[model samples]
Structures are given as C-alpha cells and as structure tokens.
Target chain A: MTVDFNAIPLSQLSIGSSCRIGEIGLNGLLRRRIQDLGITPGTTVECLRRGPSGDPTAYVVRGTTIALRKEDAYQINVFPI
Target chain B: MSITTEKDFLQELNKEAETIRLSYVTKLGDRIIADIYKNAEQISKNVILNDTNKKNWTLKLDNYLTSKIFGYPFMLLVLGIILWITISGANLPSDMLATALFSLQEILSRGFLDLGAPAWLHGILVFGVFHSVAWVVSVMLPPMAIFFPLFTLLEDLGYLPRVAFNLDNLFKKAKTCGKQSLTMCMGFGCNAAGVVACRIIDSPRERLIAVLTNNFVPCNGRFPILIAIGTIFGVGALTGQLQALAVAGIITGVILIGVFVTFAVSWILSRSILKGEASSMVLELPPYRRPKIASVVYRSIIDRTIFVLKRAVSVAAPAGAIIWIVANTYIGEISILNHLAGWLNPFAQAIGMDGYILLAFILGLPANEIVFPILIMSYISSGTMIELESLAELRLLFIDHGWTWLTAVNVMLFTLLHWPCGTTLLTTHKETGSKKWTLAAFIIPTTVAFTVCFILTQTVRLLGLG
Candidate 1:
C-alpha cells in the first residue's frame, strides 16, 4: 500500500490555514483523548498560534481552542481545506 | 420487561461496542459532529462570516498573548505586577492592623490585671489565642484582599485558559492533562480547592496525579511566610520601590520553583506508579470581556477571601492555643516546645534549619498561617505570641537566633516544598479515597522538601558559599 506522501501533518500547517483532519496516526488513550476533544477525521481545524517556545501550537477545533505539541501534532494528518 | 442491572447493561453495551470495528467509534463521532454542523448551517446562515471577523480580533490578541517572543515574558510581567501590588499594598494595612491589635492586647492585658486575673490565664487567652488569630488576620487579610480581587479579575477576563494553553506542552510532556495547570493555579489560592478542581480532568490517572502534586504551590496561607522571608532576606538591602520589586521577583522565583516541582513530580508519577498516556484537552479560551467590578469585588472578597480566611482562622486558633501550651509547659526546666525542637535540631541543622523552625512546621501542620507566629513564640521564650513592628526588627530577631542567608534560603525552600497542611491532606483523602494515595501525597512533598533543602544546604556548606 502506498502512503499519501502529499498529506502533511497538522503541525506543518501555517498560521491561519484551515484544514480537515485525516487519519489520526495515534492509537489507544491518546487517540481516544484526541477524539474526545472533537478532532475526529474530517473535522475542520484552524491553526491559531504558537506558544513562546514555538513548539506547542494552538488550534481551533469544534468551536474550542485546543493546544497540541508539535510531536503530538505530527501524528495528526491533515489537508488544507 | 426484563429487569437489567446497571452494571450488566454497561457490560452489554461495552461488549456490543467491542464487536464493532474500533474505527467505527471515530466515524460515529465524526458523523455526530458533521450532522450538528449541518443542522447549525441549515438554521443559521451567514453567521460565520459576520462573527468570524469579529472573533478573529480576539484570536489575534490571543496570538500575541501566546506568541513565541512575548508570551512568557508577558506572563511573568503580569505575575510580578500582581505580587508587587500585593506586597506594597499589604504592608501599610498589615502594620496598621498589627498596631491596632497589639494595642487592644495591651488594653485587654491591663484589664485582666486590674480584674485580678492570673497572668497565665491572660497569657493563654490574650497572647496565645488572640494574638495568633490577630496576626493571621493582619498578615493574611490585606494581601488576600488585594490579590484575590486581581486574580478574580483575570479569571473574569478569561486569561486563565490562556495560561493553561501556554503551559499545555509542559504538562503534556509530564504525561498529564493540560487542565492540570488550571488546577495548579487554584492551588495557589488553596490546595484543598485545587484538589477539588482536579475533577475537571477527565482521566482518572491524570486527575490523581494532579491531586497528589497540588500542594507544591504555596497557598494563600503560605504566601505571607514567603513574602515576609523574601522581603527580609531576599531583598532587604534594596530601598523603596526597587525593594518591593525585588521581593516580588523573589516570590515569583519561588512560585516558579513550585511550578517546576509540580511538573517534575507529575512526570515522575506518570513514569512510575501512575504511568499512563496523557489525555488531550480542548480548552475553550472564552472571549475576553471587561470584568465587572462589582461582581469581582463581591465574589473575590466574599467567596474567596472570607472563605479562606475562615478556614485558616478555624485551624490557626486551635493550633495557636496548642503552641502556647507547648511553649509554656515545662519538662525538667525546658519547655516542651524547646525540648521537641532540640530533638529535631540535628536533622533540621543538616537541612540548614533550626529545631524551632522544624517544630514550628510540625505544629503548623494544622494551618500554615500560624507558622511564623509559632516561631516567634518559641524564639522569644515568652510563652505568648509577639509581632515585631518592622522587618528590620524581625531580621534582627532572626540574626540574633543565628539565622544567616542560608537559613533564610532553606526556610523559604522548605516552606515552599513541604507537606500539605492538615486540610489539604484531608481533602486528598476524600478526593482519592485511598489511605495509601493520601499518604503518598503527604510523603512525596515532605520528602522532596527535605531532599531539596539537604542538597542546597550541604552544597552551600561544602562550597563555603554560605
């Protein structure tokens, strides 16, 4: 099976870009937690801002602001809407 | 209809869910959200475009607040300003209250003498109970009055979630929910409250981690001690505004250390017994609004300030009386207080604290607000509480008792990292419902306090830095 090489991780999305979440690459508790926060596949997420360290970026998801570390964000595949 | 027990029904539901593909749950969630959005779009038209621009302004402000270059510095500056305001504003009122209370003590003592009452009775009632309560009020009330309102103002303006947002990565790295930052903020007000606030975290493991570490942050009762010591030893050399700023900075540093320890302990717990994956959180940063002054004052003063003060006073009163009894009651020409202090001296010395300080902490277990009073009572050998008029006199008193900068540093560190008070421990017990976990909560911070102080003391002594 060939991977979708053009599908970028959510962490790479520039500020102000709106995108739809694709397959979440994490499983178990982390996956459940992400879904519980309404970041399921096909949901729209907008990149908001980076923190002082520029690693943890905030995103707008389901009318709430959620922050995710770049490492965790890397596991979330998304494409610009 | 057949009767089905709740547990059996839940088990049946779980089995049914398990039979389906796991990805179905994700699909179901997506479908639910998508349908909701579809319904919303059908009912509301052009709402997004109109509000989007207006909301983006707030989002833009949030961007700046949480920006890479400005977020942390801005947070620190705000914290420093709050501390500075509390310190400077509290000083005059505290002094005034002390004067008024002490004068009332003088009047009451003279009245007792005139009524031919015994000196011991007067000492216990007036000096031990009344003085301790008065000291707590005067020392704690002003700062709480100023600090709580300001904190409430920030809360009303919805800045706290931003704080949690900024600290989210740090807490996540510790394998806990980012919401723990908000709970820790509550801990700065009261650890028991913080313990209760941990309920906001949905994951049981993360909630437990939060409950155990809530005591790292000094509560309002401990703030007086931090400020007093920070003022005297940490910044006593400075003058005027700079002095207050330095003191605030020192307290801020102490608070930062507490935050650091919270993270460290949370990380250790997650990697060890409470090991688990961190649960993600979607924190809603509510749009900032102008805080209503009336509600801010009422809620902060009536709800927070008075509530906390009442709790502190309830414990402090009884602890004060007990401290007096210990200081006055003699065992072979040495008061019990001194005897106990003497017994703890070797260990305390190794940690750069004295027996009296250690004993004060032990006696102060009920309420931290009374620790300074207990120390003063023991130090003076007066069998009654005393409040010095000025920081200079307080410094001289400590110096006369052989307190150096190392002692001050160790005391501050110990105070910052010591065991949770009786109330916090009780709250932990209630929250965790496990004697073992509550014991862990008690022991963890106590152990950290001793180890930190020991290392700092030994290092300073070995390096001849002190």
Candidate 2:
C-alpha cells in the first residue's frame, strides 16, 4: 500500500492558494454544515483572507465566501491543486 | 433474520446505517463528494479561467471591502457617517413634529371642553391615549425615518452581506450564526422585526440564540433615550458640528457595548443549557448596485416606519390610559404610580436610578417610546403626560428629581440592556413556538440589565466617584 502524506489541513494553506478538499475529518452537524457550504471533499476552495484576529480565515467556496475558525479548518484535509 | 418482514428488514438496515454513520462519516463524506465531482466533470463543458474581464467594478470594490486591512475601518467609518447624519438630520424635524403635535393636542383638549365633555373623559381620551401616541410619533418617527432609509440603502447596495461576512468569525466563536449580525442591524430599526428576521438563519439552535439576544441591540424606541442622554450628558459641553459629532461617536460607543453584550450572552447560552456546536455558514456577498432611491424611500417609509409606528401606537395608547389612571388614583396620600415607584425605589437607588425610572420601565413595557414621557409625568406628579421644550429643560427635570451624572449614565445603560418591549416578546413567543424560550429571552436581558447597572453604580459609589 502506498501512503500519500502531502495533504495538509485547510488552515495551513496560505492566502491565494486554491486546493481541492481531500477529506473532511469532522462529524455530525458540523460536517454537514461545512458540506452544505460546498466545502466538501474534491471541491475547490481558495483562501481569501484571515480575520483581524487571524484565527478564523475566509475561503471562497462554490461561489460563496465562508469563514472557518482554526479548529474547524484543521479538521478538513486539503491538497493544493 | 434473512426472511424477515419488510418493516423488520428496514429496521435492521437503519441500525446498520446508524453504526456506520457514527464511525465513518469522514471517509463516507469524502467518497461521496469525490464521486459527485467526478460525475459533474464528465457532463460539463470546457472550463474557462481568467474571468476577470467579465467581472465588473463591484468585484474590484468587494476585494477592498473583504480585505483584512481595510474592511474593519471602512465599516466603522460608514457606520459613523450614517449615525452622524441621523443625529444631525433628526433634530429639526423632531422639534417641528413635537411642536405641531403638542399644539394639536391643546386644540383637541379645548375642542373637547367646548363640546361639553367631562374632564375625566377628556383626560382619558385626549390626554392619555392621544398624548402617548403624540409622544411616540414625535420621538420615534424622525429617527426611524432617517435611520431606516439609510439602513435600507445599505442593504439595497449589498453592503449588509459583507457585514455578515466580517462579523461571521466572532459569531462563530459565540456558536451562533453570522447572519445574526444582519438581524441585529434589523433590530436597530425595530426589535420585533429583528426577531422576525431570525428566520433567515437555517440552523434552529443558532436562530434561537439570535432571537434570544436580539434585544441587546437597542431599537428605535430606546434610541430616543440614548440620543437624549448622549446629547445632554455625553457631549453637551461641545457646540456646533463638534457636538453633533461627539454625540454620534458616543451613541456609536454605546451601540458597540450593546454588540459586546450580544456576543457575551450568546457565548454563555451556547456553552450552557442551550449548548451546541457552531454551524458553518455560506454567505454569498452579493454584487453592489446603485440603490434605487424611490423604492428605498417607499419601502423604508411604508413598510418599516409606518409599520413600526402603528404597532407602537397601538400598545402605547392602552399604556397611556393605564399610566394616567395610575398617576391620578391615590393609595393613602400618594398616587398609585408614586406608590409603585416608591416600592421599587430602594432597589432602583442601589442601581443609581430612582423609583420613578424603574416604574417607568415597568409600565413602559408595552412600548418603550413612552418611558421618557412617563418619567417626566411621574416627576412632576402630573396626572397626564408632559414634555419639556428642550434638552436643557429635560435636564432640569431630572436634576430636580435628584438625578446626577451617575443616574444619567445608569439610566442609559439600563435602557440599552433591558428586556425587549412587549411586541418583541410576542414575536419571540411566536418564533420559538415555546413559552419557556420566550420567558428565557425576557428573563435573560432583564437580569443582565440589573446586574450591569448594579455593578456600575456600586463601583462608582465605592470609589467615591459619584
């Protein structure tokens, strides 16, 4: 079996980077919410900007701007496209 | 088990799915989304990049608005300018309306006397009901007229969604919806409407949280009190444009405190009994367009201004009659209003406000537009409502009642933080479909108001600053 270890958490992606979500590591309503916002695996998301606090970052997903806190973003695995 | 009936087979399948759901939601979600994308890619046409030429100037402007460095300052500047416009523009029209309405009240009183109507009948109909309505119109209409159109203009121009985008993070930290900010802005026009606006939030838990905390944003009714107190105590020393700017700035600061309380209470509720995880939101920042002035005027005036005014007047009329009766009817040597106020006085004083102010708040529950008038009436022991000509006269009225700067500050604070008016309570009840949640909404802000005022008063007194 081959292991692909280059995938990183969405929170680690820098501004202006476009990536496809690899895996969602959240559960239940939180997972459903992210998916509902079109941040599901295989969907392309572009990093917009961090908030003034820099913990919550905004990403443009499926033609809408969505904000994710660091903890939530960490649960989503993404790979640069 | 293999040859079971259809119902049993379905039940077994559901049990299987539930266990699988608990363990592999992440892997399952990834596979499903990947399959969806794969299917879409097969059916779609050639994709094009570099679509900037088709994007209009609105997108370029959005880049600045949603930019980290420029967004917060720009939001504040726009808000400050709107508030400044409201404060300065509302003055002349409010005074003119007051003069016009009061004169009409005098004429109506004289006409009733000439028509052989008894004094008590005249008092109940003209002085009680009519006076309250008059006060509501004079105090409320101008600000709403000015503020609502400006707010709607922003909404129409598509900046409001950007507001939701900017505040989304803070609200997410509080475990509520970012759309709550838009509803809170709606609250500035009318809290009942704001409570109704909670429908936009899809998550039921976050919607309830938004509904419960909407009262932290002061509505049009309370804005009169805030503006008056702000002008008198907050920035009264300044003159001309400086005074107006100072008042606007102070009101904005008070509003910021209200927003803080909203966040704090939301955070507490989300962590406590109403506990839940924050849900993600997909906010589409709509493109900016030129706001149509005609529709802006019509919608703001007809839909918001008149609609809110009508609701307030309906509640205020009955409240006025009750207030009149309370002020006129004596228990022992004191009028019932005074007796009630006196009963509440000790606690009120401990919070830096006197009994009459507290009593006014209690009686003014129907509509907050009349709290100021009721206070003035109680202070002068007038059986009917009264209005002074200017802020200076209003200041003297308060001073005569032993009010200090401490009282003024606390009154403004209490006014801003207290429970929703009667209409908002009803709206909450309807929205939540539970009496228990409505009761919680009422109790929460009232408790916060009392606690905040008590702490401020005690701290000031203990430090001998008051």
Candidate 3:
C-alpha cells in the first residue's frame, strides 16, 4: 500500500484552509458512501465552518457544501496545499 | 523484498490460507474509483466552462445561513415569517369557506325534508355525515392550500437541505443521523411519509429511532388547531402584522418544544432499546436555484393539499355520522356521547383535558384533521347547536365547556405528542415488518404524551396557577 506519511486527516484541517485529499483509510460501506459524495483521492476540499455543536463541519467541494462529521472526516487523509 | 514473489505469495495463499485474501482486491477497487474521478475531471476541464461569479452569490448567502452566529436566529425568523404568512393569509379564506359550506348544509337538509326523506335518514345523511365532512373541509382546506405551497416553494428553492445541514449536530447528540431532520420536516407535511423516508438512514438502529420519534413533530393535520389556538390566545391585544408575528412566535415556540421532545426521546431510545452503531451523518447542500413558480404551486396544491384533504374528509364523514348517533341516542336521560365523556372524565381531567377533548382524540384516531370537528359535534351538535362562524365563537364555545388557558396549553402539548394517526401506524408496521416495533412506536409516544401532560397538569394544579 502507498502511504503518505505527512498527510493529515481532513478533520484536522483548520477553517479557511484548503487541502488535496490523500488516501482514505476507511473501508466498505463508509468508504463507498464518501466516494459517492464525490470525495476521492486527489480531490480538493476547503473547510468552511463548524456547526453550532462543533462536530460536523461544512466544506466546499465540487461546487456544493457537504456537512461531514468529525469521525468520518478523520478517516480521510489530506495533504495541505 | 518486492519479489517475495507474487507467485510465492499466491502459492502460499492458495494452498494454506483459510480466509480469502482481499487486501489487494480492496486496494484495486479504490484505485478504480480514483481513476474514474480523475478521468471525469479530465473530461470536465475541456467541456465545462467557468462561472465563478455566479457561484459566489450562493456561497455568499450560505455564509450567514450556515454560519454559527446567525444560523439559529435566521432559522427561527424564516419559520416564523412563513407561519405568520400562512396564519394571516388563511383567515379570510377559511371564513369564506366556512360561510359558503355551512350555508350549503342548511339547503341540503331542507331539500332532503322536501323530498320526503325520513327524519332518521335526514339526521344521519344531512346532519351527521355531510355536516362533518363539510366542517373538515372548511376548517382544513384554506390553511393547507396556503401552507403547502409556501413549504413546497422553500423545498424547491433547495433551502431545506441547508436546514438539514444546520441541525446535523443536534441530531448527532441524540445519536441519530442528521438526515432524520429531513424526515421530520417531511413529517411536518405527513408522518406516514416520514416513516418511509427513514429508509435513507443506513444503520438500522438510527432508522428505527427516526421512525419512532417522527410523531413528535406535528403533521399538517394538527397545524390548523395549533395555529388557531395560538392566535386566539396570543393575539389578544395585538393587531395587524404584530398579531401575526405574535401568533407565529407562539407556534414557533410550540415547534421548538416538539423539537426538544424529539431530541430527548431520540436520546433515550439510542441509550436504551435502539442502541447500536454510531449514526452516519452526511448531507449534501445543493446550490440554491431560481424556483419555478408554476411547478411549485401545482405540485403543492395537487400533491399535498388535495391529497390530505381527501383523506381527512373520507374519515371525518363516517366518524361524524357515528358521533351524531351517539350524541342523539339516549339511554335514560343523558345521551350516549355524554355518557362516554362522563365515564372518561376522571382520567381526562387528570391529564389537564376534558372528557370530550379526550373522546374527540380517540374518535379521531383515523384522522387528526377531524379532531376539531368531532369535538365541536360533541359539544354542541344537539338542538341548541349554532354554526361555527369565527374564532371568537370557537373560543366562546371552549370557554363554555370549561377550557382555561391551561387546558388550551395541555391540548396543544397532547396534540404535539400523541400517537401517530392510523395511516402512520400502518406505514410503520409495513416499513418495519414487525408488530413489536409497530406497538413500540405507538406505546412510546402515547406514554410520553400522557406523562408530560400529567406532570404539567399536576404541577399547575398544585401551584394553584390555573
């Protein structure tokens, strides 16, 4: 398997930051659901803002704002651009 | 190291391995997904043109809408405004419908008498069946005709997904998927559909949680009662837009209570019976679009308003006939309807509601829209009955029947919390394919409704406030 040692989970990306998605460590249904939402390897995601409860954060990707919860976001590795 | 050889690895795995080796196969699937996306990007670069400025406007509106600071307040304001519009706008039309329909009832009864129809037949057909259906229509149709279109307009504008986005975390705290909020919104239109919408949740446990708690949100059938009572009580001193705003605020407060109860029940269910996997929350906020007015109006009127009205009228007509019979038939002196209310009075009063109201809810099991009609029939359908003319008359009738503010408050709470209507229960049984789950869905909300009202009634009585 190819691993990017420097890549951090998308959940760690600060608000107003942009990054290129790296290897998604999630498997099976969770991985497939994310893939269906248009988040794939090398895709770019920009952190918009956190929800009032500070768990799910909204992001701009593929011309839409998709809310992703922290745990799910944590599985998707991203390279800071 | 790389040559630990594919052939050697394959031979070892083929001969000795008990489980299938799928690590490489999984990686290959991921590679294929990535390749597809990459190829799509390549094609889009050549064919798709840029329109950064057009996209920026939607993004800009969303900045405040999805922002933590303004999100909650904006949600309340938008909802309040929509409701205010519905309330004030429906008043005239509802009155017109009542006058038009009630007058027709008089003509129908007179015509039946002229045609040499038997008095018993006149009583059942004209006064019992047709009267009740007419009441449901006059009271229900105008508001629905107004409310559904406005709601559908928001839905068509793609604003509802953003609402789901805003409330995702709150639902997360309750251990259900954010998409439950979307189903709950659908529930505001109808709960039967909302239970069906629960299929969108991937995990079984979360789906059940959504289904069970869907009743906490009042459906369209209950909204008119909520709106009417809120306006009558809260709009006492205010006039014009201020009155509308006050009424809307009260309705919004009721909705907030409903939401709070939904969260609390979801929290309990997740920890207790429905506990299992963590909920999966993923919501796509589609770009806001210019809504097509013609399509929005057509769909809302045809699909929501007419469909719901038809169901309510069908049930109400028969229920009205039964109620008329019970109210008319005497067992010694008091009528059967009164006898039943008398029997139920002790328990109903204990819950901060009267026996007639309780009986109405029971008889209205098939359709919540007819609860008001049944209640009216119970209270005044005898010889001294007068036509329901306006809010003032309705208020006077309630006050005559011992309805204080506390009674009003408890009635709203019960309406918000009670068991799902017959259609919703049937839908739940079908969706879950389990009678146990269907019974749980019924038992859970009912228990919640009775307990909440009981505590409130007891507390108020103990304090001597009411």
DockQ of each: 0.42, 0.41, 0.66
The DockQ-derived docking category for candidate 1 is acceptable
Misplaced by over 4 Å in model 1 are A1-9, A21-43, A61-64, A69-78, B1-17, B21-33, B46-54, B382-387
- lDDT (10s digit) by residue, model 3, range B15-127: 65533445766677778988888888889889999788767877888888878788889988888888888888887888898899889999997899899998878888877
Query: Which pairs clash in model 2?
Result: none
lDDT of 2 by residue, B218-239 (tens): 9999999999988988776887
Candidate 3: where are CA atoms >4 Å away?
Answer: A1-3, B1-24
lDDT of 1: 0.87
Task: Give me candidate 2's interface root-mean-square deviation.
Answer: 3.2
Summed backbone clashes in each candidate are 0, 0, 0
Scored by TM against the true chain B, the candidates give: 0.92, 0.89, 0.94
Worst 10 residues of 1 chain B by lDDT: B41-50
lDDT of 3: 0.87
- What's the candidate order when arranged by decreasing DockQ? 3, 1, 2
Ranking, TM-score, top scorer first = 3, 1, 2
User: In model 3, how large is the Cα lDDT of residue B377?
Assistant: 83
Which clashing pairs does model 1 show?
none
